[model samples]
Target: MTNQTSEQFWEERYRNMTGQPSGRPTGKLVEFAEALPPGRALELGCSRGDDAIWLASRGWQVVGVDISATALAVAAERAKAAGVSERVRWEGHDLAQSFPEGMFELVTALYFQSPIAFPRAEVLRRAAEAVAPGGVFLLVEHSTAAPWSFKSRTPFSTVEETLASLQLDESWEPILVGAPKREARGPQGQTAEVLDNVIVLRKRPA
Candidate 1:
């Protein structure tokens, strides 16, 4: 599907949903952020802007980009509620088409899923290109197609496979890449174990 179509799909989903889809930063993102230097940050697929708001609250200038305008609105409200509205810039963007310009101190792609019809390689390449020198790129994605309510059937690649497919630049260093089990609330309000593959890469100085 084209980026425009993808954007519309997400917009409709958020518009119809009862409440905010996501409310907090993913665990992996929280850990990654704690280790990075605070500066300009960009969050791709920001959903309702939990991570972006969290980053902004920590004094990092943040730009939260999502395909859904409704989602961005909720994110903006969240920032206001959190008392950091001025620190965040919310924008509607389709990652498949183009990425925001500028070098970022940190870039986060957390649990951003796409249908089988979408092109994953191009998305990953664009994400890699958006990272600035001495910046960090953190990716946290579902590692398995477990029978969860929010699960996607699109076959997920391992961190190793993704990095190998991308042929990352020599200046980019892989800090951590592996599958980790996490506990999350299931559809029925029960606890379930989910596997997530995390990829933390840092760009070397120019």
Candidate 2:
């Protein structure tokens, strides 16, 4: 198995990547954000920048971070083509070593998992702290493996389980938390039912 934690592994993956967009930003991001006013936003593991670009289009100044330089390059180009380059920035980062600077009105980690072990809980703790006063941190993750997935990751934690582990302070309010079923196409266009664990939290203003 490839060591996903190493930059070289991701660099190679992105370098070999050849595909259309990673599909449009999920309805989840648009639905949760459309109601809220836009401001600075941060997206972790922002692979091909779909969600980040969508947020930029919605008038947020977005900073997207990924470990692969190739991925960041692609994201930058995508933002440019969308005519939202001025509203978004892409950074190459290994989350365990460092993260982008500055607090944000919204911080998100969508499907942020890896085959290689990672300090996901600690990273999310920092993600919570990165939210500015009155800001929101939205987490969306797969609750199970894809029907055809070959990667052997353990079943993902439920929304309730992840929240319980976060151990957030009283300053945070849970806006929404649940695992919902959705229909989706696999890489080969086969149909599958997938469960998504979604959690949205808002930080109380100081």
Candidate 3:
């Protein structure tokens, strides 16, 4: 899909959301980042901002980026409710066209997927570049389709493939690389074990 089409699609999706999210950060995000020292963070496809809020609550200044303005608004409100509004900033971007400025000590993109045609690989590469030296870039992606997902038949790239696509040099060190299985709950309360491709890379100090 074109960039305009993708924006409209995400906008409509978030606009129809019935209520706020569960106010829970993705389990993988908390698992990997909970022990890290707080610093600047950038969360791509922040959805309703649970991850960003979690980071901000831990004293990390956060910038949450998403394509849907409605989603950003909802996330901003959520940050306010969590008393971390001052620590979080929200920006709307069609990442195909532009990205948030500056670098981050912790950059995360969890399940950054879309059914529409998007340059996901390119965007992810840019995300890596935005990671400051000695900082971490954590990526988690669906390795298998969820039962309730509209893109059930869509094939996902493996962790190795994704890392290769980034084309990082020796300045990047692989901290974690594997497909991990996690128990997941579907939209209708159905439960299943799902596979996720995870890669955590730390940029070597300059």
User: For this target, which candidate reaches the highest lDDT against the unseen true structure?
Assistant: 3
The candidate, 1 or 3, that scores higher on TM-score is: 3
Query: Which pairs, if any, clash in model 3?
Result: none
Model 2 per-residue lDDT tens digits across residues 16-50: 87776774997888889988899999999999899
> What clash count does candidate 1 reach?
0
Per-prediction backbone clash count: 0, 0, 0
TM-score of each: 0.90, 0.94, 0.96
Candidate rank order under lDDT = 3, 2, 1
Q: Could you tell me which 10 consecutive residues in candidate 3 have the lowest summed lDDT?
A: 145-154
Model 1, 1-206: lDDT tens digits are: 23546776787778988854566667887887886778999888898888998899889999898888899998898899999988899977777776787878898888777652567667777888888898998888887755655445466788788778667868899889888898877646778787888889999978
lDDT of 3 by residue, 119-151 (tens): 999999999999999999999999987687757
Runs of candidate 2 with Cα error greater than 4 angstroms are 2-4
lDDT of 3 at 166: 95
> Model 1 — which ten-residue stretch has the worst lDDT?
145-154
RMSD of model 2 against the true structure:
1.4
Global fold similarity of model 1 (TM-score): 0.90
Each candidate's lDDT (Cα)? 0.80, 0.88, 0.91
